[model samples]
Target: MLGGFGTLPGKLIWPTSVTTSPDGDLVVKDSGTGHIQIYSPDGDFKQRFPYGFEPIKGMGDVTCMRSGVILVTNGTRIIQLFSKDGELIHELKSPKLTWPYSYGITVMQSNKIAVSDWTDGGKINIIGVDWRMNAILKTNAIEGFHRPVRIAVSKNEDLLVTEGQLFGRFQGCCIKVIDKNRHLKRTIGPRYGKTFSFENPSGISVDSPGNIFVTDEDRNYIVMFNPDSSLSAVIVSEGLQGPSSLSVMEHGLLAVADCYNHCVKIFRYK
Candidate 1:
């Protein structure tokens, strides 16, 4: 094994996503526990968000604000923002919001965010950092967005999303890039060949060089794409069970949320 597995002081179950805060702490959406946990760069547990709900309830993705606050998705309709010390800062929710399901989340410049949906034909929700619901990006979000499952903001500030499954069949797998206006800019998939394709892509991240890393759960691999969206290489191809999420860090450190393995895997990339 190249990357060491870490459960830290407390074991995490079914971690579906992993991200990094501005300060370099590992932020993981502890899906099985219905909470978010923070860890030091070296795999030491630091803090856990306040998760008043019981385990087995729905808890979704997580992202970090430039202010170092953590933003976590609660179910399909709520966003819980909290400080680094685990204090609740704000909750973004509305009864009238019609997003049937929530999947990916990306923090944009100027205190904006774009959240994707799980529905086959749904739009990405754009909201302000102040909890204001902004415009929903719907025009050609992507051609085959069966379930836009993960998202990341590229170095150019564009949106990168991964399609997870088609009608819950674990069939769709590809990466889509969208401009700031939500227009589809590029679709990288099997059309580029098996080496460039994915199987059940569930997580995505972009490094400073605009390199894209994606986790394909069904295939048990993480593929990398160059800044121009060309297939760069396969970071991992085996010994991984249900790799659900990934986060690209500085100095070529990559974090993988091995869902079935029940631990986080830290890998080296460059």
Candidate 2:
């Protein structure tokens, strides 16, 4: 447990996302407060700052670029970049996006940024290193997205995006794997071993070996999938309430944004 309502420097309120800096520090984003917090590898609080103008809800995703710049989405058409110390760097917007409700975000090894736009059904837009639109993932009728939220990039640069309905019945609760050429490769969820079914697949992360980890906000646990897309294990189940986001940490550890619990949970996976 890293944060909660308290006198601590890094206290979190409704944290929705977590990522690691290149130097092995944890950077967390709280949607309830629109703030980001940094903590040392040993769970010591470092600093905190507001990532947006005001406390905004549904601002649910954050990622740290390899260059140490933090990129965050505020559920708007623009994405904000900030220094590790919480200083504003710049804002990224593509003219191609109209009324985009940005949600999930991830940066590839090639510096290509993948952001999920929730408007008009849902689609992932790939941004170039120069902050221009490179490609927007396209799907046919059979592969249309319902509501794509959190996303991850595999070792081969394939995107694994989680799609689910927000209101009403939860439909399209699965991870859609799309290749670099903007093609749907396959979907992973529902009836593999008949042991688990994803309700709301929110946060996603890929380990060094290309293993995928996902947080099921509704199911209240974390699940891991091998590179082969088979269920490797149900890694975390106890003491979780709406695990919204997760990131693979250094030295075989995992950090999860336990949303309902109002804290980040760390676990050793190896």
**Top lDDT: which candidate number?**
2
Candidate 2 regions exceeding 4 Å error are 6-8, 53-56, 131-143
Candidate 1: lDDT over CA atoms?
0.73
Candidate 2 residue lDDT tens string, 50-138 = 87642347555889887899988878877788989899888776576553677888888778778887677877777665643323333
- Candidate 1's TM-score: 0.86
Per-residue C-alpha lDDT of model 1 across residues 1-270, encoded as one tens digit per residue? 112334443468777778899988888876666667788888887776654442224336788888887877655666677888888876666665555576677788756777787655645766654444333233123344666777888756788888776645654467788886678898888445463456678889988878888888888988888989888888899878989888877788999988878778889987
| Local distance difference test values of all predictions, in order | 0.73, 0.80
**Alpha carbon deviation, residue 88, candidate 1 (Å):** 1.7
What root-mean-square deviation over C-alphas does model 1 reach? 3.8
Q: For all the candidates, what are their Cα RMSDs to the real structure?
A: 3.8, 3.3
